[model samples]
Target: MSVPAWLARGVFRVQEAAMRRPTFAMLAELERTQWLSRSEMLDYQTGHLNVLLQLALAHSPWHADRLQAAGLADAVRAGAVLPSDLPRLPTMDKRDARDNVERLVWRGVPGGVFPYTTGGSSGEPLIFYFGRARQAADAAGRLRARRWWGVNPGEREVYLWGAPVELNKTDRIKSLRDRLVNQLLLNAFEMSPVRMDDYLQAIRTWNPRAIYGYASSLALLAAHAEARGIRPRLDALRVVSSTGEPLFPHQRELIERVFGVPVSVEYGARDAGLMALQAPDGSLLQMSETHLVEVLDAAGNPAEEGEAVITSLVSAAQPFIRYRTGDVVRRSGRADPGGRGLAVLDAVVGRQTDFIVAADGRIMHALAVIYVLRAIPGVGQFKLIQHAVDRLEVQVVPDARWNDAAREAILHGLRARLGATLVVDLNLLDTIAPEASGKHRYVVSHVPLHGALAQAVA
Candidate 1:
């Protein structure tokens, strides 16, 4: 049964209050702060950053030492730390976060810290602690972003996402909770032809206001619907929000064509919290009110395009100060074209798996190798699989331009990025297969940050 929008909204607000999350309150604040001028936004970020720093100094011993060593401890104490001074402290990666978690967490923080785990999509699972504030920020941020597309809280939303194990008590409870909040969940993990047909039917009946799911998963469903000539009747749908992976151009076009709605890209990680969302004007706007994002080159200097390091202001329970996110992105110097004060990002290139590691330990984005093959006229469609640090497998579906020269160019280009000592196995095929999980990745690296997390989180 469908819940009334107003009643569902009231239930959700009450639930958040019962859990002491302050979610709706934060949402109200975000709606206002998003319009602050650039200079004013910086001041807001600085103030929040200092408060998070103060919490770290008083509780998280690991972060306290780093702050003192960076020579910003006194300034932080004096509440004078600027966003620019953040570079003095070294960046922390997944390994540092995993190993030093005990000292980094403030278990006694207000509202209490709760244990959480990353999805381990990068093959590196991290167990960390987060407080209620982080929870509120993520929830409120998503609600605010959806509002940009005319999706209000409690409006019916369909989630094409992973679900808990089926036929369990927890699954039953989750299903009931989802309906109470006016959401319908379709399993992205189980997407056989028969299952997809049922999902399409269910979506037609639900008639949600918005849809959200992984970029690849959404594209797969959209392609299936298009191929079967079975478009769901979605008169109320305002937008289709894509997350998890980078939404390529072809995927966006296919999804928009099938769904008859604009595709909005949501950029975030489980550990990084909600970072940015694509606005209606086609610009990716940052969650500048709660995050301090810095784009830095390989040498750790600021650049227009490089790795993304973020500081989550609301993460006082376990401050992610100067946390290195392995994903590469380009910085947009332009302000939000939609008249918002939030900073913009040009693109989210890819994550760690999207980059290949050479035999000599050099890491470079997959585009380094892709540029080589794309320049070859013979290659039609291709997939690069890095089996090991020194070994790679290239699967190519050739076109009329296929030739010995094209083959040689593919080898030369791969070797250029992955060192000449690297071994390349090139295969010509009719088609490249999708992953078992139904997602498509141009580059798949088996060994990313090799042996980074040797043990499970205890």
Candidate 2:
């Protein structure tokens, strides 16, 4: 059973204190900063940028060299770096973060650094470290965004997320922690027919004020509920927040129709941090206090729409200044209708990963298989193609860590998810080629979901 909102809030605060995270403190600051005017917002971002650059200069030798080569080393040291000076430095990519992590990371940052992995739907598995400041910023930013939709912290939020893994002890502990914080985690990784039915019932019983999850995963669950003639009584649900992938128009319509609440899109990357989130006014607003997002074309020139390169102000544990996110986004060039000074994003053309169908007819999120590859060390840039129900192929650009054990781990992990009868073809390559369309996708599946499930998604 879910705890009362007041009790949840108290429990959350106590836990945050124990973890030494300034979550609520940061949230309080963000709550006030959200009202800054456009120029004022820029000033806020610039001040934070200066601090981050100084941190990188002092602790991160790799970034220090880059700053010096960009001719801004002295300026950064003097705490006089401006927003315009950002362009002087070259952009860093996922490979740079992976290969030069030791040089990029600041192990001595206050509050400590913790390692995290994300294969992101982009198929690039990245292992990055973040400190409590970043952790607090992400949490606070989401809290600020949720307030825009009339949903406050500790108000019974349901996460159709991927946290509940196959491991038993870890799963139980996570489940318990989620409850104390007044959050429910329905496994987005499993999502079989039976499990989805239980999810529908759980959401109804919990009566959460907000539902947050992957866009496609939420759509799939909504479709399942509709097919089974289950219209959940979710009067308390203020918004259904979609993240992980782009919320296509059709998916939005379906989710809104099924949930009886408006659907909101949340755009962010695991490596780049949270960039923007949709407000009640329907504009995607950047986290002005924590992130500075740039839309640059393929040639690296500023554009109305192109790739998103972010400078995370709070990421002092590992500075990500001018880091290329590989996400295609268009700048709105419009002011916030809600009267906030936050910058807007017109659209985010996020990469889509197709669903994988197990041999036993279980529908799994692409992350299900992606996790198999991400957990195994030595696998570099990789791609997974599901050619049929029982057949799958994984192409990997192996790094120095690739070995006999890593190869065996790949086979064992994939089989564990796709079923033991699965036929796995593992291809090790020096480079992963883009698709025939000159676009790169990390996961592709030729097999389609049959019957009502297919129709709901279609």
Candidate 3:
């Protein structure tokens, strides 16, 4: 027996309503408006900080004890403190926060409802919760950023991402709805030259106003197209936004030069909403209105600019108070004295876990591999796995036109960077799979952490 059409519609409506609650709508609208003015932005940050403090005091047993231990319970009770005062509070790790998520909500209110599990790409997975307000803020923040790149909710968007949607799952319904709402989803796992040629044809036919996808996937497509001499007139595309991985200067230039559009780079994680975006002028601007970001040193004092620790000002359900993000960053400058009071993040190195240590004690960022290999034509998805201190495995999914020259160029580049003593292995495959959380890790390292690599500034 088949289910009734009305029942299916009813179920979809319920899910959509749950995803777009009034509280979320209000928070999203507030976030949107806050970015318009410097004063308004400061007020939003202050308000979020106040909300977080209340949540922290009520739900976070760890934070509450730390506050009391520091003898600042009264100061917190008095009123909202400045950013400078925030560092004096105790630091909370992911495990500590995850273990006490239930206690972090407002008293008597069941802490915002939805529970999420973090992907263990950085070693261990974390389970946490977020109130409806925070969930809505995230969804809305994503929508807002899409708008900045000229993508609307109902427009057709070609997604060049790593994760493939299961057609047989319940998510298939949502995928269908997404298409009905005018979204075109593409699989990043299929990056062969033939597949990319089909994708280029689809772009010409669909004429999508915007392209949103992973940087590595898009870069591969551009490189493949360039080699094949198949230049599709993508003039209909207004913006191409790349996320999930860092976009190097060379990669950005290649995409822009081939596709004939601006490539907007964004930085974010599953735990937080949008963290930063490339401004029209090409500067990386942190989303200060909704998040409080800090770069800190080993002493726990602010670093001039190093590893980024973030506090979610807008999340009351799961208060990420000074949560370490495990990504290295450079601070642009101090918060504007007479401006929005939002901190500036200059750049983000890949995951802290992926920094490869060479035999000569030189630290190599993941981008070094990405920059060297992505320039080669017919190379699709790729991953660099470090097996030993000086041994590395480079995996690639090549297109039909791939050759030994491309492989040689990659090995030569690695040899130049890591010295002739470094042993490099090239592994070719049909495809490189993305992680469960729908993100691709370009670099993987088994090296254990020894010293702190992040520095922060006040």
Best by lDDT: 2
Against the hidden reference, what TM-scores do the models get? 0.77, 0.97, 0.68
Q: Write the residue-wise lDDT of candidate 2 on 1-458 in tens digits.
A: 98888888888999998999999999999889989998888888888899999999999899999998989988987889888889999999888888899998999999999988888545678899999998998888998899999998889999888742433446667778889899887778888899899999999999999999988899999899888998889889999999988888988888898899999899888888888999988999998898888889989999998989999998888888899888889898799998988888899985776788888878888888887888778988899999998999999988888899998899988998888988989998888888875667888888998666775555
Clashing pairs in 1: 378-401
| Candidate 2 to truth, TM | 0.97
On residues 281-313, what C-alpha lDDT tens digit does candidate 3 reach at each position?
556767676688888866777776666788887
Score residue 400 of candidate 1 by CA lDDT.
74
Q: What's the lDDT for all of these models?
A: 0.81, 0.87, 0.64
Q: Between the candidate structures 2 and 3, which one is better when assessed by TM-score?
A: 2
Candidate 2 backbone collisions, by pair:
none
The ten-residue window of minimal lDDT in model 3 covers: 449-458
Best candidate according to TM-score: 2
C-alpha RMSD between model 2 and the true structure: 1.5
Give me the displacement of residue 6 in model 1, in angstroms.
0.4
lDDT (0-100) at residue 236 of candidate 3?
61
For model 3 the local lDDT of residue 58 reads 69
lDDT of 1 by residue, 1-458 (tens): 67999988998999899898999999999999999999989999989999999889989999999988988889989999999888889999876887799999998998998876553333333667888999999999999999999999999999987532322335667778879999888766555556777889989899999999877667767777876887777999999999877888877888898899999999998788999999999999999988999999989999999889999999898889999887789999998988888999999986423546577655444544654664566676677899998899988877776999988888887787677888999999887776775444567877644221111000
